[model samples]
Target chain A: MKQRHYKYIVPILLGTLFSCQKSSNNEDFNQIVEANPIETEVDVSSEIAMQVIEQMPSPLEISAIIKKTGLSYNSGILNPITHMENYTTNSQKAINFGIYATDLGYVNMYNSSQDAMNYLETVSSLSQDLNVSHFFNFELLQKLATNEQNLDSLMHISTQNFEEINDYLAKSQRGDLGALIIAGGWIEGMYLACEVHQKSDHKSLREKIGDQKVSLSSLISLMNAYKSNPDVELINKDLMKLQNIFNKIQVKEHTRESKVIEEDGIPMYQDKKVLTVMVTDDEINQIRTLVIDLRNRLVK
Target chain B: MTLKRLFISCFMLNSFIMSSECNLEEFSKNAAQKLAGYTYLKTYKLDASKEAEIEYSYVFSNNTQYVLTLAHELETTDILVSIYDNNRKELCNNYDKKGKKYFQGIGYSCSATGIYYVMFSFKNAKNKCGASVLGFKK
Candidate 1:
């Protein structure tokens, strides 16, 4: 009887051990699945499609332009005369000159060629031609242009100029005009950041800009208060439209890669993809509604 | 007696397995939600030796593609941006080396809508980058 009991006890112990091992394995599997999970795909709708089409800069027109003239690098070129007029009438020409002169320095740094440097020098001279003051001086421009062959010097000069400008902006109160100029400077800084990122993968423009993170929406709201008072309706309208666009494009997920995995008998997905272009119908309609609202407000 | 013990053990094991599976699914959903809601910005110190930085403001409307002013100009380090919905569903993740504009979709079936948090950071900076958020209410 004792021998029989011992045999039964051994089998029972072995069974318990097996059960514990199996459960532990199951838990491990579950943990893996949790770490690597899958996301459900959203269904894109037709209304969203229509809205997207409406907002797109007629692809046909873009394609036609491309087909007709290949690619035109002059799309972003500002009409110098008109731009200058806007610069002066909207506010002080000196500030505008200073801003553009600084921009030229950045443009020159990236190009780092005799021709590019010459072009920037011309731009710098043009700013002086407008009789813009030293308060808005292109000291940074001179430094960048003279040190065309040195990337480190160029970066240091640009950074210093930006610091000075930021200090000026902080101390001076020029209403909306100053804000607009700063906003433009931000874009120029972004341009330089992008150049830096491209030349070296060790730094990213986004990261640089990220450090100076400002709420674009909030800035627009502040500008909106001055809208009717200044009657800069057209500019206000454009800015509002821009604000809407910014809203649509800013999404979480910093990178553009995604992955999917499976654990045990279950499958899961891990999304690492950054900057996906696919937009759902709901997203499109939302943007359309916002645009229409901005247009209506501007028209009123 | 043996049959009774086997039955009890089977029941307990089934319950434990079921609970473990459910817990994992819940965790994934939570993670997705966190990713969707995350947002941050960064700014870098301007190199004074170069030109004064240009100021720019950007807005994305109706699938419009606006070029990042730095494209072809500045050397960029790390760039990462992702889009997600209110429910935490991952929409898009885009990394740009050339400072290219990432086009937001306008009207499309299955396009995502709503407020998206665009979180971004640079490799070597301690500051945050600022970005404007714009969208229409559905």
Candidate 2:
């Protein structure tokens, strides 16, 4: 048994030795690992596999896609800022915090400074209620929201702040709350996408909605990690329903080597494969109806 | 020498068995500025487990030009990144094998939407503190 231990451990020691020699950033390994925010005892269950929610596209991605369509801004489509007070529980606060962040993103995308400021204040309030306000720079964000030229910075900072809050929550024992934030943000993004689609019936937007199948399964798996919580369990049940509808959409995939081109000394690859997303009008309607209904139920 | 090896064996056992994390207080913002002309979407702090590579999956939409900007406390772009399509097909890498050069990021424009797995590793197994930020423009 002792000889076996040496055989496996020697190689790791040599690897560490080489790593330490080449390491330019000489951080004290033990101290740094001790201070890592991801050191929390995660309660993520193991039944569901591929549980990675951290890299899911920002809730703002759908908003960015919607804004590029030249659709007119509609404040009525957003969750009302006045409803921020109704969420008293930690779960409610975290979820609404995410919803308000997405709403704030939409407001920023349209360059509505006044509306952005309102959403910013409300998001800050909710983040405060959730004890995550330290992750946000409310004054700087408010200042940026007032200037239309700062729209990009405002959007980036808002998204980054929400990411920080989620990270902090994950570091503590509240990773379930982080999952809830993602769930809320994702549902609101879909709701906004569906509502915008209802307005114009954009063909590309429909495909984009269908393309969300990739993240949908991962989000569902992530939610299942925290299914022990009542809020997470209920949300996961609804997400599974969404997943079922998404499962019905057909996507044919093929792959080939991308044509690589050099841009400013960087490699930019143009993917050759194109997938035709086959989502019928009926499926779209089902997804849209369910998204709107689910979002409304959560917020109301 | 035998005692030293024994101590290292025990230490390695502890590290390999436990979860690895990094101390990246402000990882993303520091790198986002480098990749201008693109709107920041998502950022990931790399776990500093040198023995293992970090893999993150993101759903990238086609027709949108996306860039994955990498930053490190090492102050060099020598960090290794390999991007794979949803099918785990190799798409592109930051290393220039011909020129022996390393770029700071990978730019990808796909014609189809799928989950792309971005893997980041350090060349010398020295990946304790670094991050990757994903930015896009349609």
Interface RMSD of each: 18.1, 3.8
Look at candidate 1 and tell me the lDDT of residue A28. 21
Clashes of 2: 0
Evaluate candidate 2 and give its CAPRI docking class based on DockQ.
acceptable
Instruction: Give the C-alpha miss distance for residue A118 in model 1, angstroms.
Output: 5.8
TM-score of chain B of 1: 0.28
lDDT per residue for candidate 2 within A1-300, as digits (tens), equals 000000001113324431111111122222322332332222332211222556467767788789889999999999998997788888888787778788888888889999999999998888877788898899999899999999889998888888777767766667788888988998888889999999999876888788788778767756655666789888878888888988899887776765877766568878878776789899999899888888898897
Residue range with the least summed lDDT across 10 consecutive positions in model 1 chain A? A1-10
Could you tell me the interface RMSD of model 2?
A: 3.8
Q: Over the stretch B6-116, how does candidate 1's per-residue lDDT look in tens digits?
A: 999999999877543323223322322222211111122222122222121222222222211111111322223343443445444443335553321111111222233
Each model's DockQ score: 0.02, 0.29
For model 2, what is the alpha-carbon lDDT of residue A61?
Answer: 72
Model 2 achieves a DockQ score of: 0.29
